[model samples]
Target: MTKLQSGMSRRYFLQVTGSGLVTATALGGSALQARAEPYDTFTWISPRGTLEVLDDYPYWSALKMGYFGDLKTEMQPGPSDGTATVKFVDVGQADMGFPSPGVFSFAIENGMNLKSVFHMGARDTFSIAFRKGEGTRDLKQLEGKTILLGSAAWQSIVDPMLAAQGVDITKVNYVEAGWPTWATALAAGQGDAALSWEGLRAEWIANGLEFEYWLGVQHSTLPANTFVVRSADLEDPDRKAFLEKYLRGWAMGLEFGYLNPRAAVEAVYEQFPTFASNTGPELGTTSILQQINVFRGDMENREGWGWHDMSSWQAFFDQIHAIGQITKPVKAEDVCTNELIAAANDFDHEKVKADAEAYQLSEEFAAIDVENIQAHMFDNAV
Candidate 1:
């Protein structure tokens, strides 16, 4: 066996990247701290290279709404290698990460020792996009057709989603057409379909790259992306307390958005001005609502936000295993836990709703006919 050379940790690499945005103050405690002192900063690394997307509105909403309180936070855009989110969290480069269940499974199978504490995307967000009126409605028709992807690492995400629909994933061709341009590649008639998702459906339309989509929320029953962290870190009381506070911020943020979505969009716009100028108020708000619909699934029947259904996750793992994506029998409990759900949701709902409704909106954002937007939200849903 060959021994690997020792290198700098992912944390050090993140510091050197000069891309981290420090947004808050420290709650005090390092990953290895033995005492009860509060940690300085809690860094969250995104799976993608940019945080300007609408997919993470809850975090930004929390930031703008002062939900995180005194807990200092940093948001880092991890490399687009796909596995870097969980890998960074596992190596202590970041305190938390947002990763799909498929990526989380891969980490568990490879002994990464991470746990998904927050089930953010309660429903499937993955979708297959096709050129308008130029593609078949049937997923089985996708067999043997070329599918464009932003990265080869996304194959792990695409394979299970395709297999769930009775498509022969082995026969489906995936081409890495590069990020922020794969849909352009598809529009250029280079592929039959491209991997797309919910929030992106609206953002793409805003960018004028419209496409018809077979949305996973309407098609599949699998669990979507979730917030994960190193399993070993949870054993520390101080760290766990910090986590509870951090997640509470997200829960409150979700509640805020669910109450008044336009405010959430405004929060994202306030956080990233450039992103606002590009997507604009109409589609940007639409994108925020699109993701919220995925994040809030049957709230009347569920316990609360970030709650995980063990059976659904088990079924997901079973399906991926049947598709040969996972080599071993991986149990749901081994990779995720609902332990933090209650603490994360320990907040006043009515108060959050009050805050959301009272939030002042810009004339442009307030002018959006939200009822009309919701009515047409599913126009391209297959």
Candidate 2:
């Protein structure tokens, strides 16, 4: 679950007016094809910074596993913004891109020829965290309290989530503060709660901090980031071949990562050597793993990998439409196709599960320890 900022048309709210915002096919088609051949190359763009975060893990892991076969991945670095990703695919500069599903709907309504091919992760990483033992039992309890956000940009996201819960947003005070200093502000009692990531949940629990929290996804069964491509790519000169192979590799990497988290980090570091960081290697590993953990909050309960329920998508888009975020009609069937995912789900799930369960880290990766970065990660666990 990560924030995907699709370039929504900016509307000035001068207190006088308002504004608005906004899979998978695989999946496993290699079955009947004779010695499959993957497509030539796929130019893909990521929603976040280039190959640096956990959100890009499966793609990196796939590269590590050589699942791509003949298909070469040409990565175009994103501006680290979701809207940019939507733009990349819209203009055909890239064949595929990743962006938050919430913002993605706007792209479709605005007449972008994109369709989400797979449920990268159906839930967002966003959560509201406040001081533990603050007597806040549920999210609705913050009726008249303050919720802190990094910027006014958060309103499009947090407001819908709040309104969905039936908590009158006007009744609750919203404080704008710099994310760098939001933690201090929260500690100083300047805000009752702050928006955060699910990765912080485990850290707070491990440290015995009773930070009361509610995940936006838990309250709103919304779609998060997705693996998307142009509708033309699905039809003429169809790219489903590449899509299916790409997903298999992706799914494989994810299973391997689960079995060997440290190795997964090392794979990305090794494959994307350009991603040098001032942060230590261990911190990078921990951060990537934590972000990977975000998916499990909802994935573990799903029927299979990359499963996207129509009802969930409807609930989210319905809410968005109800809130006047989108007025143009965009049918889900036109934008998403499950044929590929159904094919992928048909893969040997039982075997994949067993392999992952029995997986052991290589010597190089086994040396990593969570404690190495725990001290630095407690407050900001990406």
Candidate 3:
């Protein structure tokens, strides 16, 4: 993958630590305190600047439902740098990190000894959004059009997705319109389209930047995001057990969202009132339901949530490498595993579903017509 010119890099990570840009005390000093001792708090870092986004409904749901009973947890919103989440986990600053498959692969290529423990997004969540009535029914029509991106680093993400659809990526132009504003730029006619994903689609509408979309969840065959941790931790029994427990909480949380998307949105809203006030209950629920669809793709054929389809992952790796996004070859088994999947799924399904059905909602959340929202969830999807 191409390194970000203004973002984090392997050399930058090493140089920063070596030059004291990051204080030793803040980075666990010399002992890496986060991993050296068995701690009560399990920290999961986000790949973005804030955790207020609706994409993390599962974690917020788990937090609200007390699914992680007695297991102290912390949700740390890392920097907006694309590589910060994996870097934090690599240096023991955080216990786990949620990274896109592209970012995870980049970390591995840079020699970070990390393993994806839980495959959270079973399907690709990336998408391309065009001004309403301006998108083509076929991706090939985008060959000569420009696509807006939050950062140049995202080109690596868009390349393979376009290639998968047989689009001539060489003919496509990408413009880095900057983060937190790419959607607005698209609305202002700054570009022909902007990169987007499941949860963000609803949030964009709430922001009044509605656009027609070619959703990756419906088009791309690549693997999506996953939860990764230090590989060595998996060998230790205590850490391994804790990892399973953490993943189980998320799995149950996903189940909860599937059963009651409104309740899931209510949980997220309780955790992030500012975000709730901005998007309202209807759009918040819409976002949660959108991700629910990605998180649990082809449920009938899958063993459970967090199950990795190694074949599909392998194909994704092959496609990226073929497109020259990855310089070195990557094997699916080396980057991810399904060992924790069975243990993570060993939970009381009936109880989780019951909890979802019984979850109390705020007046606004209670008034949301989730069925109607779901029924038109893909209205803008091309």
Candidate 4:
């Protein structure tokens, strides 16, 4: 057998060997199928706008390659509103939803019954942006200055970081500026600084807006993006199997993207035709890949792809609980299971490693211009 097939066989052997005792005890006379039947359709929701970049081009590649066919996913892209996504999943309007980790954690703590299954991007994508060559070298300089912020959760991350540098948030005037108004507000001198993600920073810098990034001061340990399914759905054997298969496909997609970024970009362009006109397909794809790489940089070598360990989850949960974002603490079991991810790791270690290496070597890893599609769309609408 080939190395890949041999690996698969080994994993199957392990699964069969490990579960043999449990199967004998759990089912004395009943027959258990070796493989579950695939679902007909699985609907998924994602935030609207450029944030859809989280969906990643390799996902499209995987879909085109029939990676998710085993689960029979229909793959629907929904609006970007977190509240709406949560509501849809809770009411059965949607089978799954992707929301920022902060939003999902808050929802779960409040008894939303939303269980996070997979972490899409693994790092804190948010950052503070200031004009280059300004006195905004560190978090300390922001004291007594007006800063534009989105909302409470946004400030939660910033406040702690600032306080660590002897700067109290109360000392700084925090204006309520939505994300749509951030770039303009900062450029128009409405605030001394703005809180944004690296994608936004990339767009602003590309547009000739030079800014200094405070990489040292991060506000939250929460996973920036994640996939969640309703509690009821988890009880269904077919649905559960589908979820496992979907995650396997997703890991494959991510691995493919890491392996061949250019091909993945082409795949995304073909799937999302609108991407062609939005910001130049090449640029958009490059931007998406770059952001993924940035997040992977933290735990690339050790953790493997899309692997969220118990310790990392607990650390992030504790941060949320401490900030009042989550009313009650959630145990790691409440969120995700590493069993399937571990299975994926075992299924194709060499492919995973090769993909990781390719991502580390890609040219897009250096830099890519991100367009402020939010701003551009608003401008065109007006």
Candidate 4 per-residue C-alpha lDDT over 1-382 given as tens digits, one digit per residue, 9 for 90 to 100: 0011121111112112453321111122222122222334566765432323434564676786666665556554443233445545544445677666666665575456677777665766666676555534457678788777655335544654455455755777777776456667877777888766644554554445656666431443545666777665567776666677777777777777666555566566666566444545445554555555544546644455566656667766776566566678878777765545654443464754565454442354234333443233212110
lDDT of 1 at 304: 85
TM-score of each: 0.90, 0.69, 0.90, 0.69
User: In candidate 2, which residue ranges exceed 4 Å CA deviation?
Assistant: 1-40, 131-137, 141-154, 170-193, 199-212, 217-220, 271-303, 328-331, 345-382
Model 1, span 150-251: residue lDDT tens = 887788888888888888988999899988789899999999999988899988898788788888888788999999987766887878898999999999
lDDT of 2 by residue, 44-160 (tens): 876543555445666676676665666677766655333556665655445677766655775665656678877766566667787766734366788888887655445556666
Ranking by lDDT: 3, 1, 2, 4
**What is the overall TM-score of model 2 with all chains considered together?**
0.69
Query: Per-candidate RMSD vs. true structure?
Result: 5.7, 9.9, 5.2, 13.3
Q: What value of lDDT does candidate 4 attain over all alpha carbons?
A: 0.55
Query: Which pairs of residues collide in candidate 3?
Result: none
Q: List, residue by residue over 1-382, the lDDT tens digit for candidate 3.
A: 1111233323223334553443212222222313345646788988766799977888888878888888888888866666777877776767798888778877776677889988888889999999989976688998998999887767777888889899999999999887788899999989898889899999998988889999898777788889999887888888888889988999999999899888888777778878889999888888888899999998897889999989889998898889877888899998889999999999999999889878777787788898898899889987
Better of 1 and 4 by TM-score: 1
Alpha carbon lDDT at 54, candidate 1: 82
Tell me the spans in candidate 1 whose CA falls farther than 4 Å from its real position. Answer: 1-38
